[model samples]
Target: MAVGSASYLELLLASDTDVADFDEPLTQARAKGAPADQLAELERERALALRVREILIGHRRHQAELQLLNDTAHDLAALHDLDAVLQAISDRARRLLDCDLAYISLSDRDRGDSYIKAASGNISGLLRALRLPSGAGVGGMVARTGAPYSVLSYHEDKSIIHTAEIDRTVRAEKMVSLLGVPVVLGRHVIGVLLAAHREQRTFSGRDVNALSMLAAHAAVAIDNSRLLGEARAAADELRVANATTRSHAEDLERSAAVHERLTRLVLDGKGVEDVVQAAANSVAAGAWCW
Candidate 1:
């Protein structure tokens, strides 16, 4: 293998599209029947170049993923609309994973199951409405284990307990590959994030890690959104309560003022006609007395 300098890696970083400049010359040298030793060195250089290209591409992809995540975080911070955040998560997952579809299934602990809450890219109504029993499908397994799960070919995967409805839905969507990661908040698994492809595709460890990171952020965002919603509701309730308390205070103050006036009138030994006149003066001029 040809040893490369730090500068060479930096050059690749500068422009990933410059692969042809490094590859075409090596191809021509081989075709011209270069010396065996020279050819070997060239071949090593070519291999190193290819490796550099892969690294550059991976770096660029990772950067994109981070950018997407940062943008999502900003959006979540600005507003706590859960549906909007979930929808953004689904869309970003599909783009980052480069998959045909992506969806989030939230755990309904009360129901002991997970249900699809948000989806992006190609999807059917049946798939949208799909639910997985606890510890049943891939998502369910991820939910139970709080781990990441993947299958290059879902039809051939025997590790996951397949359900008839899930199988039918997957077939209908023509999804052959799947990757799911648990969305965890603290120690509890709150939901699962899923990425799917129509064709069989093997996901790398990098892919799994990227998806897992997104799942982690998603969990935080979901929790944040929920807390924000609760906080807003509590604030509204507090406002209503404050308004009621203020109204009651006003009513009490008015009653106390009337009582003070009546007490003064009695202390002064006012006649019944004088007391009635005082009461009449207390009432608004145009208001009717009961």
Candidate 2:
């Protein structure tokens, strides 16, 4: 046997003592010249151990990769600010998937449309300037479907139309593969997460799954940001309204005071001299005469 294979077999044998223990009595009998059957059993046990070791090693590597992905997702969830969250997600997706372009498109719910909120790499500037109506293209279709979609050849895909802005700027129809996943919160689709490769390539199922998970994180972050902004705006309006109400109340109180003084002067039936003196004092104090 080769050195590497021999070492792997040895390690496996050491780790699984039950196999060795079963072989121990057989080995002792063989030492006393018992039979060839006993020696064959020892070789069979060693083979089984090698197989188990290979399976165990494969499982361990898979588990380690899963743990790393989980850690990255937790980090994404920790971000609160909407812009930062989108940017981080886009960056991570681009790096993890080895895509040429990645972007997050947030829906403008009030306008019934969607716009790219953040992007990474050369397409970032182009995405920032683009907006798509609901159900317009791949991103919109993903939003409407609320599911993941992928195209291995975008140029050949008749459904995709290059935005006028993108055509004017990039001038390269180099993008060939595209994938989009909806960002959904509750029953509503909030946005779309997009990834694309420059050359025609089929996206793996794993890539789609990872992008979907990232989209979920983005949806929650966007919803929180919208709520926070609305709350601040409402607080400002309430403050302004309160100030207006107070000003109106103060004006009413001043008018009532003026009316009371006028009524007292009339009710007293003061002589001409007293009335004239009161009028002179009121005029001197800048009171308007009707």
* Candidate 1 off by > 4 Å: 1-33, 272-290
Write the residue-wise lDDT of candidate 2 on 64-94 in tens digits.
5466557767886787687988898888777
Residue 51 of model 2: what lDDT?
Answer: 73
lDDT scores in order: 0.81, 0.72
After best superposition, candidate 1 residue 254: deviation in angstroms? 2.2
Q: What's the distance in Å from true for residue 54, model 2?
A: 10
Clashing pairs counted in every model: 0, 0
Model 2 CA lDDT for position 246: 95
Q: Estimate, for each residue in 19-70, the C-alpha lDDT of model 1 and write its tens digit.
A: 6666665566668877787767766766786797887688888798788778
Best lDDT goes to which candidate?
1
lDDT measured at residue 221 in model 1 versus the true structure, 0 to 100: 83
**Candidate 2 wrongly placed segments (more than 4 Å):** 1-81, 108-113, 123-125, 133-137, 158-173, 255-290
Would you estimate the TM-scores of all the predictions? 0.82, 0.62
Number of colliding residue pairs in model 1: 0
